[model samples]
Target chain A: MAAVQSDDPGLTPRSTMSWWFRREARIAPYLYISPFFLLFLVFGVFTVAFTAWVSLHDWHIFDTAAGGGTFVGLDNYARLLNDARFWRSATNTFSILLMSTIPQMLLALVLAELLNDRRLRGPHIFRSGLLIPNITSVVAITIVFQSLFGRHYGLINVALDFIGLDMVNWTSSRIGSHFAIATMVNWQWTGYNTLIFLAAMQSIPSDLIEAARVDGAGRIKRWWKITVPLLRPTILFATVLSVIGNFQLFAQPLLFAPGVGSMGGNDQQFLTILLYLYNMAFRQFQFGYASAIAWMLVLLTAVAALMVYAGVGYLNRRENRSALEVERMRERANARQEAGA
Target chain B: MTNVDAVKAQSAAGPTPGNERQAPTFKPNKRRFSWANNWHYLVLTVALFISVFPFYWMFVVGSNTNADVAQVPPRITPGPNFIENATNAMNAVPFLRSLLNTFIVAGTVTVSAVFFGTLAGFAFAKMQFRGNKALMAFVIATMMIPLQQLGLIPLYMLMDRFGWVGQLRAVIVPALVTGFAVFWMRQVIATSVHDELLEAGRVDGCATFGLFRHVVIPSVRSGAAVLGMFTFLFMWNDFLWPLVVLGGNQDAHTIQIALRNMSQTYYADYALVLAGTFMSLIPLIIVFVIFARQMIAGVMEGAVKG
Candidate 1:
């Protein structure tokens, strides 16, 4: 045993200096990653805890009161639960999130499929073009979109008029406002998501598709049976990412709802949670109340993200696109083709 | 210090030719577009047009007179008023200064994020220390925090206390380190830097830092550059936080803030504002032109590999 122990390079008994050197090699990783943890502790972990703590108090930035404000012990949270604007804003957030995310994700998958075409010409140009909107400031895009979605003589309205359609009040009405703002979010993100999906799609081994084709499957059939299932993990990851980002939905709605005091609309029609939080903290100086809203927003975002995970799981069960099911689908497809022939 | 000198000398010596080594082979596309692939190209072209038309429209409105912008058909073609509108935009807002401020913020943020992210990414990828998995998961878990929106109040207070309020540092520092960049670099380094290479470095008496500086840095150069591109774009385009912190300090306003100033007007000068928007897109457009290939490869790598 002693001979074996000495034979092992790492465990060999050596001088204290050698042992210390070995110890550092193990601990050096901590030194490497400490900066992130330090910042995470202060800026990330500490801020979250502090935000929660602040939400429990009656803190006001201007009052400069002692002890930062009285401890309300869930009073702020209680108020938030009853706040009408909060509910309205919550609904708006959810609706806009759905409106933006679903279409954007669908469009991205389609575009990615197109971009992943092996024989596509100038493919690099198209990929880069798609990402331009993402790289351009989201705020800047919102500003441009705000102009484009103008009430009259705006590009969209003019386009609508030319198409023999009535131009809806984009900034004034609820659905109109949500649709316009959602369009901005959709346009800005779809391309980036397309690239992500494209990358994932490209990595899907050609053997899988070729095998499906050899099994007498058409292109669309092969894609549905094989590619879609394989891309599920990447899709879920992309969805969670979009949910986290879209839930914030601040600058777009704020800038889009022009002349409405940045309340998302005159009636707060499309007011998101973050915008509402901004108003509560910055406009009303209700830091405590705003913190509560923020806390709730985070929780809801987490719930939404987790629900996506579970929802996809539920979809798997309901769709039941197991290999057996796919085989059945392929057999049905082949039968139809034979009958048609 | 000696490690730094050694790296300088080694890199100055340049890469050693390795014609003997087996490299991964790729079949290059030698075929151009054929008639059968016309529809695919057409679809991509249409998508490309829609993707890029917004910038074109921005230019159209920017270079045109406001009267031309308000026309029924709207001026689809570029007008000759670009110089005038640009002059108006520059005069109306401190755009030049704000542009300079944006460069500083984005530049500093990119450098810091890339450097620190590369360092930590190397450690995470190669190191076999305790709690590596959990710490990495923790890093990833924090990505969902949405720091800009959630921590607004406390961050403001912290900045206020630190006397960084309305200073560019307020924008630069908090953004210097992000969970995404760290996580991204981690993935990049993990896949790109092979274990055998690090083993070789270690056998050559390279310490942990030495391995990182030499073996890791060169191997992960493209990844670092990609991370830097993303970080730069993110920092350059950052809005809400800078708007909140730099609200009081116009001297420190970023391009986004300046553009916001033009955008939030009562009458809304479409020509001037769009001109400002047009101006802001130029730098990024230039960057895209230069690094589009690298950026595309970078995106694919991060997505597919990770």
Candidate 2:
């Protein structure tokens, strides 16, 4: 075979070519994967650049910016920084993130714990069921959730009334509407997070837990001192995802908000940064301003992600130091015992 | 990694009962259920119910008539009007035409993605290539850049300029080169395909492409099938781009768009909307039901290995 000849090094002179052949062999995988990078270069990098370029000008979707505006340098960014609407959208994004992601992660951890239980029957069924919401069409989910959250005649209100509570205008008021959106998000995503956590949990060694139990630690004590601390990486990953996804919260709010064609709810209650940008560029035709806003959002999310990464890294380093200190004390004890002997 | 492992081991040790103190106590070694273990079944049951209830409601609503669905207390019963509702859905929307369009778009995209994806994947995995490490890293990292974050306007513009807007090619062509599919295929091919097999084919006078055709393709068929299914589902269920590109173009509207339009206009027609929604879901459910094992295997395999 060609592989055998190449190994033996007793083949023809042409086969023995060294510099060029070796270099080509080294680079072949790169050649194979080039299409993705090529597309990314053209479509991905260029798109962001074009958006930034457009943002610098008074770009409009329909009419030319020359009709009413000029290329005001840093004006859009300055205006956005001072804009109440931008701040309100940012607030809405964070509020929804808090309302949804915190509980979602907690619930996921609980579910993952449950799944890891040996007594649980048909765990696969439950796991697959969790993924159902993830697989369903977003459009379909939004529409279904809209009806379910409707104030007057929705099933949610009906259930509320049965429990002797007044009907809540879920999609009208800012706080109420946010709760509705958050619930939808939580319902759809909790299972997904649970599965990810479960995967993380399953990778935990049995011997560690056995040792902890042998040390006379109760289940709750072990979980707090063991599982929670250990699942940090998975938690960090999920949290970052939640943050990014919350920023781009569009379709649900766009659909759930009661008004006919509004991007956000009444008073711009649920308008996330991405939704605001979408409305500005596509709806209001403020393409330039929208581009600036979009770029700002990208920068904000990146910074937030980095902050989380650094914070987690610092905490982990501290934990590692304490662990190493314990090991040092144990080594000192062993040395003293040897000296005494 | 060591800390993570240590913590995992601690949790896996489970809980020792108070009976652990007395070795002569009745079954002293019996494990005590941790609060987590005690609550596990309860939590799982609650999660399962919540998860499955919506789909259960969808199916329940599908069987009911429009009037029944709108009634004061929503009927939990299955009505005899599912057939009538389905007929109405077909008449109101160009259901058959849209289905055909979906099939063509998803089919072409899936087939092309699998074929090209496997070729590229195989080349990356098996062949000696230049710049393989950097190129593969680039391919893998592309998943982090949100697609909608980039290329929304220009992608639309590109399609518009090419006169591919509202054409099935608009969906198919872009989808045919997914980074994920290529990565997946590369992995599957690397594990399944043998260098020995390819060398044997070369020794028997097979050309590079011929070796791929005769040997590699057959070996990676299951991987291709799984990837093809995912490609199909993604295209079929896509809404935003389809909505933008096919705006108000009835002839080119996808099922998702049609369903959205129907729900928005016929807001009170819960039964009809639910029926339409269920109809859209049937293909996915059927596909999953048939290939559940393979799909689950693929996902679990990725999780363990990755």
Candidate 3:
């Protein structure tokens, strides 16, 4: 009976097939990971394509004019490229980025250095203190900042006045408004960057610093020669993140700046690209045009990121070359000294 | 080799003479207390005050009437009108429903996120399944995809088709399995959970589910707690999705939606709005303190490698 069962083709097929399935069980992991990709394809990829398509057509949500969407190819792109509002928003975005990210990263690095000092106690408390702004809801922080920046009885201006400065028309003036918004953004983000930088700094070996110190290097020299060079990767990472974040600046600026739903100020000074896109899409119902702007923004961001990558790479290569030269010279000098001795 | 040693020898001798430089054994000095050590403390203390002062000031403003709040130089002290302001805010919107809705949505998201995130994490980390590497890479790449601006419209449409519009699940359900939680859980599991233990359970005839529950779940309890807390926090403070879907339905609003509506319509009522805002922060602050360790660890863990 056993021999007959073993010789049966049906049983043989079933057993070998099951073994193959078991051997190819790696497919289950793909299945496990497929849900995100599937959702992203439908929700992310398709929508992006649809948005681009819609941007090309002059379509209304209500479809009032001739069943909606006259296929006027490239006109939207032409207009968006030439649009003053688009240029203005891009300028505002960069301006705010400069105002917020530059000082923010610098201050964060200094704070991180202090935190990294061996003598400093209760690093946890300092770490927690740095995280408050990160964890606070953007809404709550915006509302509070709005109240504090109020022109008449605002706490910030009042404090400024107490220090012999004029009561700045923070929201009414374009630059003032941008600065106000930038201040809030910096406050909310500096701590986050500090934590990141601090973590990066901690990973740097203390032995390097000790070696530098033994070589008679001062704090400043050590920072420049060892710390800054080693932290370049972290800086590049933080910068790219900051760039992306700056382009997507919405909530705080939207709240702090005048004009409902982010028209920027009276002068459109703080109207970010995202805010402009939002207005175009939702407020004006120009889905097609908004999509073009979004795609353009993405392209621009990618280009900017690529440029930074190239610059960082070039600088690193140059530094490495010079460092190698220095090593070679030092080695030759050591050989001569050893031969003379 | 001689050349290399000579170079090293020269470099070592370049500073402080070899004997002085080699005195790495120890340098003992009297522990003189300097203000520099306390300087960091002072700076951090000031930052902490700035961080906490705004919330305290919100309470102070909340207790005052509108006139009192608008007074020049600002009222630094609390007034006696907190009850009136709170009552006005409560009456303005269905605050209780919002609280309940927020809690339920956050709770559901937390539970689902922890369960799915943990399961997916374990599978990716431990299972000897095919395509594991590709799946892990896909999950990591999803973190870089800027979903906020990119996926908003399509996601909204999806929710619409599913008839989840104006429902809290519209926000909660899609977020149950995200790139962040999945990656985090996987990392935690890889470090904490051992493969041998799972094998041992299997050898003992433990079913897959039984192995997960009895062996895997207990091991990753702390990781799950951290994920759960953050999931709850994000849901609680989520503005745009709920704002878009539930804009017209005041009864279906969360605290943020209700608060935004109040502020949008009644920006002049600084006292009442501040009261509502202050009330909104209470639950989060309380939760944060209760889960302080996990919260801190979660932030550190996420930032450490990144």
Q: Judging by TM-score, tell me the better candidate of 1 and 3.
A: 1
> Against the hidden reference, what TM-scores do the models get?
0.87, 0.83, 0.85
lDDT values, one for every candidate = 0.81, 0.72, 0.73
* TM-score ranking, best first: 1, 3, 2
lDDT of 1 at A158: 93
Q: Write the per-residue lDDT of candidate 3 for residues A151-203, one digit (tens) a residue.
A: 87778888898898999887777677778777877887777777777777888
User: Using alpha carbons, what is the TM-score of model 1?
Assistant: 0.87
Docking quality (DockQ) for each candidate: 0.32, 0.31, 0.24
Q: Per-residue CA lDDT of candidate 1, range B148-250, in tens?
A: 7788988887887788889999988887778888898998888889899988877554567878888999998887888898888888888888988897898
lDDT-sorted candidate list, best first? 1, 3, 2
Q: Tens digit of lDDT per residue, candidate 1, span A1-341?
A: 43343235365445643454466679888998888888878777777788998998899986433548778999999998899999999999889889999999888887888788765567778998998888888777887888788887689999999999998789888988888888988888888889999889888877566546656666566666677787888889889988988788888888785577377777999899998998888888888989999989989999999999999998778766575665665576567668889
Error of 3 at B231 (Å): 2.4
Residue B53 lDDT in model 3?
76
By DockQ, the best candidate is 1
Q: Which is superior by lDDT, 2 or 3?
A: 3
Better of 1 and 2 by DockQ: 1
Candidate 3 lDDT tens digits, B118-189: 877877887777567887897888777666566555465566667777887777766767788889889988
Poorest 10 consecutive residues of model 3 chain A by lDDT? A1-10
Candidate 3 error regions (>4 Å): A1-31, A63-68, A257-261, A321-341, B1-33, B207-210
